[model samples]
Target: MTAWLPLESNPDVLTKYIHKLGVSKEWEIFDVVGLEPQMLEWVPQPVKSIILLFPISETYEKHRAQEHEKLSVDPGVFPDDLFYMRQLTSNACGTVALIHSLANSKSISLEDGILKSFLENVKDLTPEERGKALENDKSFTEGHHELAKEGQTVADPEEKVNHHFVALINKNGVLYELDGRKEFPIKHGPTTDETFIQDAAKVCKEFMARDPDELRFTVMALSSV
Candidate 1:
């Protein structure tokens, strides 16, 4: 599988990347100072989505396995319009997460460019097929590579990246966790436009609580600039 340099969780770099990929300037990425209520207050209103970067440690892997098993028997309601795709390439989670964040956000206007075109082409494809489409799209891949290099600390493409990213969005009042590496989008219960940041923050807190000693987690929101 092809591997690209991992993207740092820097708002400026991410904002630039999304802008380059066709997301309108009306929306920009901003760091979530903390998961607490006080910190969420600093984030701009009408947050479109939240992206989380966390370590892919044994603890996370184990929990993911357990969660998958439990959800397999009782998968909750999946919105037919939910946009999700699998991550087929190594180190592509950041880009996948960004795509998930933007694609599902109907409120965010997309320009006629790489991301907009890619999403439209894959709108009717299965999740796996969407992943394949992304892998084969030269324009999208080139854009990702170009922006990945702008990170503060770019890692070698061949090096193993221990961290992964996931996007959270409120889709029709339900909060969903969209991780391309996962088999399916995980439902995180109900949420509203006004409470999306707080709801996502709760989930982020849960992730931190699972691995108390790990401190590599980062959170950011896509909101009005």
Candidate 2:
């Protein structure tokens, strides 16, 4: 959330890309990872959700950018915002270490759909276990909604760090926020993630066109630092 690159400086590439929002299911974002091996790996993934790192949010991204170039703005925004943005960018960046860990072992007991199915098909499970399972299911499915609530007001990802600064009413109208991502105000079109990864890869290839060195990585690196 702490990207100090005055939004006025670098044109909002996302806005431009949003204008080109045709029928493609891809993710195009600028996640800064300073010569890090992990960052380089997920560079080509389609990013449906973007936790912008421009201006630079983390210490590593900031440190690298500082060493590589002169920074004209503050890169760090806020701790809460950073944590929240991390959630959004984690999956898109193709590096979800925590998710991968939780997904296994409890694959049949705790995941989103798998657990839901288990509950639905269960005929003799303890009431407490059933309730616990239900609670976990709700938490897992509400990820997007939770993020939207925190981020919607800050149309720009960096601004998400200062959502509290936005006018309450105006904040309610922003898309990344709950008002926009929610079903009522500005419902997002139903976009299946099945093709999302493919779409992201295609877009990356298109952007890097002739640059063979920037080719997509086979492994999805979950961490940038």
Candidate 3:
């Protein structure tokens, strides 16, 4: 996936982290890069997927809301939705792709896929209801598109959509979409792993490197560009 990688515990932190790459452009491109602290701790070792947990605030709706429609602080941020918080998360799919490639990871890659919903995971779905949702992808795509655009759109209406904002990798390895965060229900967040399945998956991938290295980093900037 070509979406900008979310390199932190939450996606909102993108407000500052994009600058580390030395890109002179006005915005950041999402893609995979970097290892988990644990992966890096091992050094020179390649990484498995870096599980990135981005804080998705309940107040996100408030920030983009019209003045009168704005949410009240009394209620505080919207209560965190564990489902939304879980699967649909990440800085950028680009970061995922880069990391997958850099670490030589073999996996189905997509930032949105991490957030996409599947009914088997939804607790309330009647078997029929679940089947219905699975057959519909239009509403799903539109929903994700809007969310992603909310954070990537420029203040100036006429500004061209910034290419740096987001990108995606389809199951078939195609650049399927744009704006990573908008790409899912977040309710359908990434699937949880069983310890044994995770271990077996890792066994098939090469995570060991032969040496050690260090690199310095600096923050640059954030823009809707």
Candidate 4:
């Protein structure tokens, strides 16, 4: 069986691919290099979602298991309209993160394109079903594979990578961690248009805390112009 290959974590590349997926240019993405309050000063306002790129290690797996065991993910607590899906294949987490961000971003209108069509088709399906649909989308799936090949030497399809992307979005006054690999959206805490940056920063920091000695974590945000 062929699996999806990992994508390079380049902001420019990511934004370009996001644009190709039909997200408007008005919905820009900016890098958030630090978790400090000062880092928020330069970030554009009305941040909708925060994307986290981190190394996947045994430590992360342990934390994932622990979090799953300890935290009760009340899927219903999240907004009824939130869009989420499961990662059914390896190396597709980046695409999953992009979808999670775009799907939940209410302000950005998706133009007529593959993403819009895909969303329409999967609108009523369950998360697992949506994932299955994605797997079968040749045009969209192949587009991602092409993007993954740019700006770096393409690795063999069997080669494994340790990094993944996860998105944290605020919807209906609540903060949700939308990880395709997770069974359900994780409710971190309350959030709003005014406080989502700070609220998401807290959750991002907790992810860092889980692997304090690891320094491979990166944080970025999707926001209005």
TM-score for each candidate, following the candidate numbering: 0.97, 0.19, 0.21, 0.93
RMSD of 1: 0.9
Rank ordering of all candidates by lDDT, starting from the highest: 1, 4, 3, 2
Model 2 lDDT tens row, 1-225: 112211211113332222232212222234333233444445553223322211212443444345334323432222121111122231121112122211221211332343235334432543334333333444333432233333324334344331110000111112121111111111122233333333333333332343345433222211111
Question: Per-residue CA lDDT of candidate 1, range 158-177, in tens?
Answer: 98899999999999999999
Enumerate residue pairs that collide in model 1: none
Top-TM-score structure, candidate number: 1
Tens digit of per-residue lDDT, candidate 3, span 1-225: 112222332234342322321222333322223333343232221222223222223333243243224323332222122111111322233332222221122232223232223322443643234324433434433333333344543223233322222221221211121222332311111223222122322321211211112122111111124
Which 10-residue window of candidate 4 scores lowest in summed lDDT? 70-79
Model 1 ranges off by over 4 Å: none
RMSD per candidate (Å) reads 0.9, 18.8, 19.2, 1.8
Quantify all predictions' global Cα lDDT against the true fold.
0.91, 0.26, 0.27, 0.85
TM-score, predicted candidate 3 vs. hidden true structure: 0.21
Worst 10 residues of 1 by lDDT: 147-156
Compute the lDDT of residue 177 as modeled in candidate 1: 96
**Is 1 or 2 the stronger prediction by TM-score?**
1
Tell me which of candidates 1 and 2 scores higher on lDDT.
Answer: 1
**Candidate 3: how large is its RMSD?**
19.2
